[model samples]
Target chain A: MNLGLDRNTIYPATHMWRRFSYFFFAIFFCFAIAANLLAQDWIKSGTGLGVERIRIAVPEFKAANQDPRNSELLRTFNDTLWNDLTNAGIFEMVSKSFYPLGQIGAPSDVKFDTWGQTPVNAAMLVFGNLGASGNNVVVQGWLEDVKNPNSPPVLAKQYTDNATTQQARVIAHKFADEIIFRLGGGINGIAETQIYYVSTRSGHKEIWAMDYDGANQHPVTTLGTISLSPHVSPDGSRLAFSSFNGSAWEIRMFSFDLNRMVSFPRYGRTNLSPSWAPDGTRLAFSSSRSGTPEIYAVDQSGGNLHRLTNSGTTNVSPTWNRKTGSEIAWVSRHGDLPKIFTMSADGTNVQQLTDQGYAVSPSWSPNGQFLVFSWMRHYGPGAPGSQDIYLMDVTNKQWVQLTHDGGRNDFPCWSPDNRHIVFQSNRSGSLQIWSMLADGSNQKQLTTSGTNSEPDWSWK
Target chain B: MKQSQSRWIALVFALGAILFLGACHKKAAPAPPPPPPPPPTPTATLTANPETIDKGQSTTLTWQTSNATDISIEGVGAVQPNGTQQVTPTESTTYTLTAKGAGGTQTATARVTVNAPPPPPPPPPPSLTEEQLFAQNVKDVYFDYDKSDVRADQQSLVQADAAFLQQHPNMSVTIEGHCDERGSTEYNLALGDNRASAVKNALVAAGVPADRVKTVSFGKEKPFCTESNEACWQQNRRGHFVLNK
Candidate 1:
């Protein structure tokens, strides 16, 4: 290992004492280089390019005790953990059939050779054990680098909660989020995030919320009025929406922590589509209190009302850039067809991002780079196009259609992680909420049995 | 000698009397014009917090009067000498707050520009009175797909409706804007608002009152026809008029 050095120049004119010292220095330098190589975070750097994907395997956790409840809890945990990892979008999941036989509950039972070989070929492996300890279910999970036997495990986590199926799922989500944060390059996993949307299942259009994976579907607002546009605050404490207050449309606020409607001032007239600023201190909504529907910004307490658009057109559906809160994208009806526009938060430097189409429901991406909206490019009667969701680069106005021929897909909202999008579609015979990858893959239906629309993913 | 001295004295006395009268005349000429005693002039001010408002919306009219005993707002009648009142003016009006005092009469005006509601459409053939006539004359104004502006072809319909509304001055109609099942719920609600407002404004321009022509947007929630077709959708996108008794 010459290391590009001149060996003759170093060996000549050196006594035995100097030669020994030079050898020792060289050995120390080699060890330093090796240590640096081990310390490098390849996953974090590679994830930015989105080019590399780690092949990982997650085996079902073994039940430490034979209690009847253990199997049920373990079943829930295994299912939740697998679903969370599959939705992570950064790993190539190895099939369980290819995993080596026998339950590996402890570190001594793991055989790195079997997992790193062909067929399994998993660079990383996740295994865990679940056991009941007197009214609590405890889970111990590990992520081992199967390819590098000498390297330490990527993550080792322990979580304990009530001995219930729900708690099992909770523990699984926590463990999977830890794995995602370590291997998916430091971005917090959205598995624990909730999505707030409107559902008519309860006999009225009220605000309903569900887990990010569509579990525990429940209603948040029992206002019993027609509520549209549920926008969660950045802090996940309050929800602002437009509801018919008997006489006219008014923007209303609901506190999730309080489980009731909070006092938000009535701006009067037809107010709709309340979108919170990223800081959660203010909100921008459309109000006809000014004669025509125009965008207005107000504090979270419904004060300091500032008019953002005065075009005298029907401006609605305003969404803020969640990362910067500097730009707001909204649907404006200034021209023949409704188009999407972006402007500074103070309502200066107006720029139109859509040329032709009935574009509406513009939601800014969490990273502030793209906007997802619903567009009908070929509008008018007899036009042969369907309303579909699209993702656009806000800087260049370039766009990609996310949903194709999906029956009246609209109201596309980006998840907080910027990795998934939840939107409403009528393709399933009725209006329901659906979610997909940000790049338009892995489309899944999240709601059924009722007409649901206008999903807003919570900001974690 | 006694007679000459007496004559000189008399002449001096006459001259002194003339001087005294001349001085009195000059003083009277320079005196300030007097009409009894000066009285304090009444001061009054009136203002509307929101000077402009929608037809059904309300605004606060704050007023202050000084040196006033009798004060009254023309439309509001007698109010407090200094206070605020919420007024929902159906039409644009200038409220005059007249403050009367012992000194004089003072009037302060606060102009509240209320957005006038749409007027009635053009008259149709003779019909029965009241609800029946309203139903027969006030036609639904249809719109183009995804368009809120009153279409060119639909101009005559709005005109006729406005004329009818103008004839029935006592009648008020609620215009419900409906959209076809095409756009998002929120956007359609806004589109429906535009459609209803467009019709209402047209009627107002055609001589109808805005307060009489209230507007509500149903968005795509309530469809006239549930079929998913062009004909049904065309029927669905309309500014429907309902006679409010």
Candidate 2:
């Protein structure tokens, strides 16, 4: 055969080359379509589910001791943690009755697959020893996440408490927050905060401080006078409270560490609700200094004074938005019923945030997006005292009732992350500090020893 | 010369071929030139009767013309006390009246000064003498603790009360006494009574008639709400006077 081909043969070869190019183009087009489909699948798998609903199994916490009394106390802890976690809304709880997994302990020995058998995405096993250590009951708890039977479970947390059996609910709240953090986001565990409130101990009503779960309780003022509306300073080192000693109801400052108390100047005949500024250098409180209870901001050293409200109404319980330092929410009696009002820090552009029945004691969320306050509905005469905790979204001015069917729930203090709220309630037969999820669920009592009320959450 | 001619012919043919190709290509359709951008309609600059007009007044307006053959003025109102106005102009007027133009519209307003009607006349002054004035102004006298007898510390406050009673002979004064938040409520009530009686005795001793000084006891029921301190408590435990003409 001749090595060089003729023109007719060349023409046939060019036609074949054109056909091969078309075939390659078709292949490329199919590949492009396939690659796009694959890319979409990958993106969907990565970010399609914004947040997975975490199903948590809280096996009824077992007490190290088999004593009936200790078992009862553990039952309270179990109930409180269950309620708190449910209220948090971050967990889809598996009922202990249907836990399916046979008694998992917190030593990381639990089979993960056994827990995964149930609809539970994760399992929280609280195993701890509880007893009296000196004057307090020490509870050592360890939590574990049992998701897979084969893999080693993660040791979630260990908690130690010096509270009495009645105050064990607080320790349980601390453990609940730990489980929440292990799942994903950061939260304010009950162990890390405190509450400043007024209690009728020492034969008189005086300002007192206690752990968020109501464990370590002590009096802040010993003036033998009546103190009302005690507030924690933003730095969490001091407390500002209103006391009626001999002059007017003066706002007094007390150092938590030093245990020393000092009085602010008597600006009005009555002063109440001393709320600290976000910067911790000033206090926003309600004072009758201008002849009515209007909101006023004064420096920690009692220097620069600025009136934050001019409605001449009884504006009480002034709380500053933690994120936005320019706005404050307070209870104003400008209408028939006391409504929640928000105003600029400079006493301008006043706007009403709530038209609900008589709202009081507003506490701000850490993000400054919502405010938790006590809502009171007047019944037939005699100081209508049925109050419940309500959360109001500041941006949209919509309120979510957080406590329902509880007998007199009030004074809600938000956790630093806004996930949980600690409030006071008489639902447990006595007034005590209670912790619940911000969404009105899992109502767990925190205090049991004395009549504890007005629980203010500490900022860590 | 033949080669040169061939070169010129190639150059001309190549140029002609490029021109023909350019003409044949898709011409990019000129992107439709964005529809000529719909000639920017001029905004109407409204000129009111006065730059700063008072409440309840009207102003005259005017303006320039461009493409608009007819124009009208609308939305005219007065600025509120907080410096905001709501206007609703019906038809276009002129500089002396109100008018509109092609460049949009303009307004000029005649000063329609709306002075807030004069405040209601001040209420008639109270008809009281110096003595009555003293008694009315001196509302009460706050006292100290434990001692029913008037203390020297409360001498100045008692003197003010006595002076008022001396001036207003026609006015009868009722001394209402109160106690601090401490102690039993019943005990405080009696103590308040004693304190008011002591104040009445002091006024009598200072030349006011005993019949002129009546005493009442609010006791611990009423507190002046002093600071929760020793000094504030001392100020709260006292007697107050209510004068009736």
Model 2 stretches astray by more than 4 angstroms: A1-53, A57-89, A92-108, A119-145, A148-176, A262-268, A335-337, A355-357, A376-387, A403-409, A424-435, A444-452, B1-245
Separately for all candidates shown, the number of backbone clashes (residues 3 or more apart, or on different chains) is 21, 47
- lDDT (Cα, tens digit) per residue for candidate 2, span A1-460: 2211123322234543333233222211112222321222111111111133355666665555545566666777777777666655555566666656355444554555666564544544444455544445556655554543343444445555654555778777777777555543343444446777767767676777776555578877787866666778778888888767554557888886886976567674556678877888888887655444578898898878878777654457788888767888887764434678888888788898766455667889876767888876453236544677876667666554566665777778887656568887877777677887555555677667667766777776
Q: Which candidate achieves the best DockQ against the true structure?
A: 1
Model 2: share of native contacts present?
0.00
> Which segments of candidate 1 are over 4 A away from where they belong?
A1-52, B1-129
TM-score of each: 0.74, 0.52
Question: Compared with the true structure, what per-residue lDDT tens digits does model 1 show for residues A89-139?
Answer: 667789999998999886778998999888988878899899987899989
Question: Per-residue error at A280 for model 2, in Å?
Answer: 1.8
User: Candidate 1 docking category?
Assistant: acceptable
DockQ of each: 0.37, 0.01
